[model samples]
Target: MNNTISSVCLPKTYTYDVEGQRVLVALTGNPFNYDPQTLYSLAARRNKKRGFLFVSKVLGKHVPVNPYVPLLAGINLGAHFIEKIHGVHQVDVQAVVEAVKKNEQTKEVYARVISQPRFVLPRETLFIGFAETATGLGHAVFSLFDNAHYLHTTRDKIPMLQPALDFNEVHSHAVNHLCYPENPELLKTSKTVVLIDDEITTGNTALNIIRAIHEQYAIKDYVVLSLLDWRTKDNRGNFRKMEELLCLKIRTLSLLEGEIDVSGSSYHEQSPQNLTTDTENRESFQVIVEEQLLNLQEVVSVFSVDVNGQESASPYLKVTGRFGLSSREDQDTLPLAREIGENLKPHRAGGKTLCLGTGEFMYFPMLISAFMGEGISYHATTRSPIYPFPKPGYGIQNAFTFPCPDDEGISYYVYNIPLNYYDELYVFLEREVSLERLQPMLRVFSQLGIPRLSLVIASPVSRKTEKR
Candidate 1:
């Protein structure tokens, strides 16, 4: 297949061939001045439901980007939301766009924009981020609003807490999404609800959640926000039908809007290589546990039981907005991140550092990495598997696969981490797990030649550790 690259302008078109599957993408709307290449790259998914995946460049999920890049993208999306609610002249959307563009060159401008006062929404709004991938992106967008309630859907089920809502992402590897709000009143009230995700492939996920929410809460207004909107005309008509059926309003916003055409037969799957086999000096790596940071927050007493009835609890701070957070509580994230970053600073070996966030725990670590000083890149482990192609312009050049530290039965992957590129690595986990389960991940780091490894756990539970 032939590939064509075009300038980042409206009505731009490009094609990608991933493992013999052909994907043609056309950008009919580029009002935000986003260069497609900088925003995302096309890669084939390992799943059969979705053949291709837009590995986001600014999402800090599949790619290790400067933390400022994803934050700027969130700021830009927030500004766009304000413009849609208030008049376009009300917010300086261009300023946010310029800051997003500046992130391509340097991150200095991000501080200036973040220091500016947040835009206070005219009314209370409930912002819901989809689980796994959009957890951090949703928080970034929610942080820009001074009057909003935030929560992200989760796949994990808390034993004591009953979910306020349940929905599904049909094409996702993990289909079920559960919403658990600490306060039930958060759903009953809140006139406006914003559904945030990284991309809108068909708009079905948004519609499904909207329908679910309306059936219970009957919220009148809904807004679906994403970095990319690829809904075709018929797919968009579904949203219109839903609005009419519910007698409500639905507005959609995105940095780029286009149609994606994917064709060709199924791609052959190859067995994953054992990347940890080269860990000859695994015992030589230093493992440090920063337990002093446990003072930041208390662990949720409720246990999350997996399929095997294995009970696990998250040791993370409540500020993740998982159990629902008000605008004031959301503001506390920065200070907490700063404090953790300061505590981790002295332990740094002063070379390139990589901050790795476990699944669904991205935004906080990204923010913490920003405060950890320069030469730092942030990304997270994901359940979504994509084909790794070691070529220029490919989104995932390499991958490290391991059993999830939280759940050994599940496979987790971290992509694009080049060997011998980083001097130190900090793996942040929301829950406290035994060293036995973490050995798989630690061994992968050992193979990468990262000499210093820090396991930053938010749980206050003390555990025995061996320091090399």
Candidate 2:
């Protein structure tokens, strides 16, 4: 007799009850294309080019993304534009909450979206959202598409993360290009694969993904959804071109229309000359994490971790440790988080000093903050933000932009800690570092107005000072 046990993983999405279930996508104001000043002061006069611009053969502003279009993104994403354009929105965030409430309007919108004469999604149909950008909207859509398997691509990299289908976004941060897709079968067998993103700029990103998926899974039909659609009537030609190119049909919907002005050639690189500098002093900075922020919901467990390696002081800062795992937690992440958390001590949360984590570094901080009592706020920046486009009275919902690192560029994420927002910060990394790279990163933070507070969670010890 063969012994068998059920798999701990989620079952195929084909088996779910969607008898009367509906999924809807709503837009607040018109769609604003993302072409904002990536490095602007919040209160600075709003640039006229801010907001999504529609550039097609019809509205031929066609230079590239930044050259023709200017948009405001981060501070508050597209929600900000909605508040500005339609007195109807409350800039503080309730509008997005209200818009997402899924009331009757939500039901009606879903009814239109899932317009199949019959009810219920077919078995094997999956919801595939883009990484970094559509992280939230994908989750929201998942809430409604309860019957669908919910998994979004992630830029986060653990020691070992595999990608189902890796693709590219011409305009995105370099570090986040590695997308770890959750469902490998997502490209295969699913009849309806929903491509969700915040906004559709050139529709290039979507086109790229669609092309990749076609080349891989070869799905015949795909649907593109967003809070706003900036594509003008002429942009439809590109859609037709892709349709002919891939022999697949891609349909899109949004609450309204907007446009993005283009100025430079598509290949023009917009790397900021001095955004992400790499030579800040390391030990000059220190970190204190707030403890009250441990154990983030429904995900990983939080625990106390001890350092594995001895600490030393030298021209370079050295810190290393193994993250202890709680019995209730998955053992895999323990060694990593704990090993790093210990040396980062004097841990405290809820204050000006921030312990910013790289993608999967989320758990380490959660655990580290457990030791760090009240003096910190724990949040990480996804490679996404709302940006101002050149169009009028419209906004782009979710597009991501990063400072070109070629010159010392800054990588802004959804959780942007504007320099004015915090006294100082200690950016934590999951990558290997030298004293030079780690130290200078700190000094740079100091220059930004606050003393730098940094910690080396997992770095090698140096010969200058053998013991801590």
Candidate 3:
């Protein structure tokens, strides 16, 4: 079955009876403007704190999906947001609705954008994407904005980069997120800030980040951008109040909006639960995996910031659009991506391959993976820990555990890869690494029987650091 949002994987109205209450998620087409069923599939969450997970077919998380789907989702969403900002949202919304009525996928819908007039924001406008899930989506949206600056939150903190702001995602497997922009001035002078995430369940996480940033800097306006918005009526009211309390204007733009009903025997009022997991060793799959690992090829590449023709190495130098990226820096991305893709071409023999970014190091690998063609799927190693239940219809099927070198206390996970599916794997990182950090991931892939492997490590350099 095609797992994309435009496929028959979901229906207009989906009902689930869990934990005794009959819950319904309705995505009717006519009046509401967009189809929620076309955007997401409802699945059970492995975390008991949250009963249901709104599995996004386009977000490229939890599911193996085409890379273009999520990228187009962000670009279209960015176009919609620009229209809303310019007070011409009706035209854009109608165009999107028409595109959906024709059952268009991300690429087709993105083409409809030509029907709308161009909209631009100030050069100083800042775009921030939530980490792990929305990192690429957020960057894609920023790319559509011409020269706007972009940064995604990261749970990993680089020693060389000073922290600008920090916040918590209370219900997430990894709760803390730190922002360490290489150029501190990027956040200080912005008049409008656009916060992007894959989904907004309660609006609390957005509120937390907004509250934290508003405390440091006085912002004129804030835009909450997401592919899906499931915030309740009360949640909307609270956002309005937050706007008033912060003395700033707040707005939200999403492709789909509706209520999710999570009822029945599975529903429980959850306490603030800590993320804990019991590691499972898949001894049965070890032999085949070792054979594949032995046959795999490995390569490493590095990028350093140039200063007067001299290359200098620094951990947080901002090469991958981690902080804010402009058009000039972005120009280097395509060629580098093409180079990475060319290097992996000889290993392509028809089976599936995957490119993985370790934690917040996602956008660069995602971009490079796109150049590797259709067979290469993209995802990341995330700090979020979820229960791995290999049952049908669950969001998380299989998970590979690795120690988080960035944070020794917490373990990282890469999920949903079935055994023997991927023929090759490419791993990307931002820093020079030791073999200690790679062993777990290598062991996991070896166990899964993925024969070929490529490791790309790029170091970042900052203009600000060079100036000093």
Candidate 4:
């Protein structure tokens, strides 16, 4: 319970536990705290694998010049910072590979899974990255696989979407994906195709996507990979049904799989004040640590902002004077945001801020986290339908409900942010959203606390930049 830290966007919880250590140490490289040998030993026991491996997002953060790493060279993985590449960013190969090797050690039956024969992949294959998340991931995976042809899903307003085949990520922030293979014959002509993503759960996402391609392009062979495979027994059964229904063979490979069971209300329900994996029948996805909070006072100050869906300005904004991640290569994004997060930490007095983004806009929240100093609780709000469950054993839940920043008049990601933890809050809105609509938006944020709520919209409503 003592390990929790606070920051903007992320949920507050303990820093790291036994499970977290295993998951995190892959990227963290914190040697002295727990023996690298022990994590290696622990990971060795789980040995699980799939023919193809897909890594979840590999997440990274820049910590203030810590006093400890200099003293301990093993901890000096790098100055850019130690990031855990799981579920948060593009699945990091180092972490996924290490964890896969570790898990293989404990479970001998699983060991052989990671030991599959290495095949010489084509120099380039058609690569499909899911929207938003797999944006960067698709390319990363493409880089690893030979002859990778790369394309990602997008929300860009197009005159006509010549989708080869389409599928609805019904449970996603928005059930919208459009694909126009550069070469209409690419999928049709290729004998093998590789799909990239951060995680592969029920295999529904993979199945539907694969089905779409197969139906439209008639690609017969496919490979699915993720950092973790938390597919339950039923989910696997349904996967087989989809395979039989489509009459195609699909193969999946992963670095790790959930050993502990998970089945509860919604995967996200517990408050920032009470995050405990100890609950019965509940398995939790984590950035780090576990905790049973003793008080709310530990929450220093909370800053909340609602991210707009537009792709301009920056992927994320900052209250503490730091810039976060930007999707496009803007000369303006990197230097400013990185500078702010790095310099702001030492000035802080151990307070917490909650930076909440609009539905489906997770990339911004993630960028903001990298800007924050240590002790920040990180989690973005999404519009996906999730049950408001706070007990253990819940695997999935809708995150939140919010209108689209675009003209579609839609709603997106709706989980992870609860208002009780904030003391001071901020909301980011575009200039076009009139004060009337903005009023209702502010009303939602008012629940956090009375603050000199600040807003930013550099461009006016009539001529703002186009959304990506």
- Top model number, TM-score: 1
- Could you tally the backbone clashes for each prediction? 0, 76, 10, 71
What lDDT does the true structure give each of the candidates? 0.80, 0.37, 0.64, 0.37
Per-residue alpha-carbon lDDT of candidate 4 for residues 174-281, written as tens digits (9 for 90 to 100):
557766443466556566666655555567778788877877767766766544455766877876777788787676554344322322222122222323211233
Q: Indicate the residue-level lDDT of 176 in model 3.
A: 77
> After best superposition, candidate 4 residue 319: deviation in angstroms?
22
Candidate 3 vs 4: which has more TM-score = 3
Model 1: residues with Cα > 4 Å off, grouped in runs: 6-9, 88-92, 102-107, 269-293, 314-316, 462-468
Instruction: List ranges where model 2 is wrong by over 4 Å.
Output: 1-123, 150-163, 171-183, 244-247, 262-440, 446-468
Kindly report which residue stretches of model 3 are placed more than 4 angstroms away from their true locations once superposed.
1-13, 17-23, 26-38, 46-48, 87-119, 265-317, 347-350, 388-392, 460-468
Q: What TM-score against the true fold does each predicted structure earn?
A: 0.92, 0.45, 0.78, 0.47
Better of 1 and 3 by TM-score: 1
Q: Rate residue 376 of model 4 by lDDT.
A: 48
Candidate 3 least-lDDT 10 residues: 290-299
Better of 3 and 4 by lDDT: 3
List model 3 lDDT by residue over 54-130, tens digit each: 66766666566655556566766787787778654523555455443443453455445533433456546788998
